[model samples]
Target: MAMTKKIPDTIKGANTFCPGCGHGVVVRLIAEALEELGHADDAICAVAVGCSCLVNVALGIDKIGCPHGRASACAAGIKRVRPGNLVFSYQGDGDSLSIGLAETVYSAQRNEKFTQIIVNNGVFGMTGGQASPCTLIGQKTTTTVDGRSVNMSGVPLDIMKMFGQIESVAYLARGSVHDAQNILNTKRYIKKAFEAQMAGAGFSCVEILSPCPTNWHMEPVDSMERIAGVVSAYYPIGEIVTGGGLNA
Candidate 1:
């Protein structure tokens, strides 16, 4: 018999993300985690504006589009209203770390029982590759043609390090999708965040170091190399917090 398709039901069809972009990989990981955890039908995503918005179409599951940088706030509301549903927010560095910083911080402070996945490509990828809050100090972008200067722009925000300090954060981790091992690890971290949310543990998040080939003006392979090389140096991969919230 021809092998039955094993594609996760959460994945409806082909994605429109740029070739070599890591958003596709991260979306796949989310689907895999939801399917494995038996939350495919119960999952609800609050997608942010930008490239992250496309995830709503790529994943067949129910989702709501939030205002720029408001995905976390929206997801938290959904989770609060429908506590049984598995709720998560998909956002980028520009949305999560920059504009949505207040929402993200207070959500953790309130111990909102939900998961958030932040894709940190270091730039405002969908908006002409502007330097984001997480953009490296010397990384070049449309707004930082001379490479980011500390004097002009403050240091890149280490979101995980900052969020991990919250007393109500149940889980916080950073991972990359640049290699096979790292991809697998990223999936694990994502799954753990979802599990934490399902357990009624407080807020949880996973910041994924993703690649933006088109925005970065690099080939796909070189973009992956940059994630493994330049990106990982500042945003180290690994779990930061395990348990320190309501359930913990």
Candidate 2:
């Protein structure tokens, strides 16, 4: 009998994320995408503070830890200094949309040569579930136990649509990992982002609608369903930008 051998890859480590946390799934999908493109060795990832800061240990890649909301800037610098390597930034909603909004916007505006993966869980999971920029209307968090009110907190920012407005952004997509079909689509979108960057087409971003069971106060399975149902309903999953006439 022949034994099946497990291939050595970047995601060969203990699971560090909470149960039902979507960050691990997103990281695994990204690693698989990197392997599929044969760019794992040449890839440099910048991680931001919050739940995604420990992704370096999870993915075991050439990663650098950046301050809250600065992963895009770090990734931009890395790509500029080492244009030969593939660069990507992994950030959470609080990191990317709240504190790092300026960096994220500027990088996209300038068309930085890198990819950005934004995990939108709608709250600051690492900091006791504070409401974030992507928190949906009527959603409850630690800070907003009565549910988010548009009058008090305003509305969730449409990040994908905002990035789509920038001509420098070559590709932009929003995906979810709540279902098998969505998971497969998310994988495909991530792979496309890698390919686009490798082809030097400019910046690309994939916003993943992730789940936070701990903060949501739901069972793991229930949280997954909520992510698919409630979260996906608010943030529809699909490609928003396709590089226009530019080919990867």
Candidate 3:
């Protein structure tokens, strides 16, 4: 909990995120990392649509709104034009791994010097409870009325593992925010991703397994439990890849 301290000049309004959601937490971690690294004032965030848009409410720095699934591309452009700025993309699983897959892959392949923080809640939180590309097997969403059927929907995309094949990628990790210990670890992973960017190591990314109680049809507490017990199990937390290797 202590990892979050809103930056000075943050928008003076309550965040619109749902109760117990993790998007706020992840955004705060990013803000903390930017401040600690002395880039808070120069940080440029490209936020994608869906629940990701709400993050701007609490973000204090300047930002741009990227078209759905285009946060990575936008961030890449920002970094290219203003190489001194700390640029990062904030996107949801549905946006990053679904509509934005091509851009995300190409950016990593190019080793764009930037950071990405993806909040994978398994469902499309803002646009109805639809199953996202990261949805687990048997996970139910509004679209998956009877739980996810791998035969019909195919397997959940193992993006973190897939990123390991990209030699240009600097760091890749998946962390959940369902509990205190994982929150601390997740913040660390986020910081590492930013540090990688600052070092010009290469493209950096961290996937955060967040809870979506409103869309998942469960209590907030239950959603956290699902992330801790099942979601993380399938995703396999910790650093999946570090410095472009399958280090997990």
Candidate 4:
């Protein structure tokens, strides 16, 4: 596919995600989805720190840089103020599910009229590959060199399953970008979440299981393979909740 031409007008500059990081793909998908949904000009995004922070420069949309894991809260504030605008939060697993957990949960509880995208790349890609809330059992991150044992780290937080039960959440899905087919599916999930927000269906979230080659310390292709195999097996893929316009 000629992604260059597909680059929507919403993208202003280049992103700084590592060479093999999946954040870039997710960013492109967001831009395309917003443009396709006719909300490019009306969209505002709150971006969390970590690798996700790099998206600030890439997306031309009005963006707010939240402290640490406050992206959801920031996005919620924006939606509350400008109820007519389309707002979303771009966050990393570590950033959203950890310190920002309260914001994310409350946003769903209130059924905020906005969208959220969480990149679940297992490790904290931006800060030396530390263990994150989504890091899988037996996974080896810098903080978990001996592998994440069940006793030490418990279990990886299944964001989709955990959040799906929130009655206020109008839509929820988890996808990957390890391959072409999965990439398309992930894009569809993102677009659907955005559509749910546009329809005023309340809070929507799409969790993307992405590869962090630089953090995983593997070849780019090997990291992709890990996502297609191990990571996907652990997190699974597809929509976890259905409501609003989520099922296009």
In terms of TM-score, the best-performing candidate is 1
Q: What's the TM-score of every candidate structure? A: 0.97, 0.95, 0.93, 0.94
Model 3: residue 169 alpha-carbon error in angstroms: 0.8
Alpha carbon lDDT of each predicted model: 0.92, 0.88, 0.86, 0.88
Off by over 4 Å in 3: 1-13, 244-248
What TM-score does structure 4 among the candidates reach? 0.94
User: Model 1, 68-160: lDDT tens per residue?
Assistant: 989999999999999999999999999988999998888888888999899999999888899999989988999999999999999999988
Superposed Cα deviation of residue 116, candidate 1 (Å): 0.7
Per TM-score, what order, best first? 1, 2, 4, 3
Residue 79 in candidate 2, Cα distance off native in Å: 0.4
> In model 2, where do residues sit more than 4 Å from their true spots?
1-8, 245-248
Off by over 4 Å in 1: 1-5
Q: Cα RMSDs of all predictions?
A: 1.6, 1.9, 3.0, 2.4
Compare candidates 3 and 4 on TM-score and give the better one. 4
Candidate 4: where are CA atoms >4 Å away? 1-4, 244-248
Clashing pairs in 3: none
- Per-residue lDDT over 59-123 for candidate 4, one digit per residue giving the tens place of the 0 to 100 score: 99999889998999999999999988989999999999998988988888888888889999988
Task: lDDT winner between 3 and 4, please give it.
Answer: 4
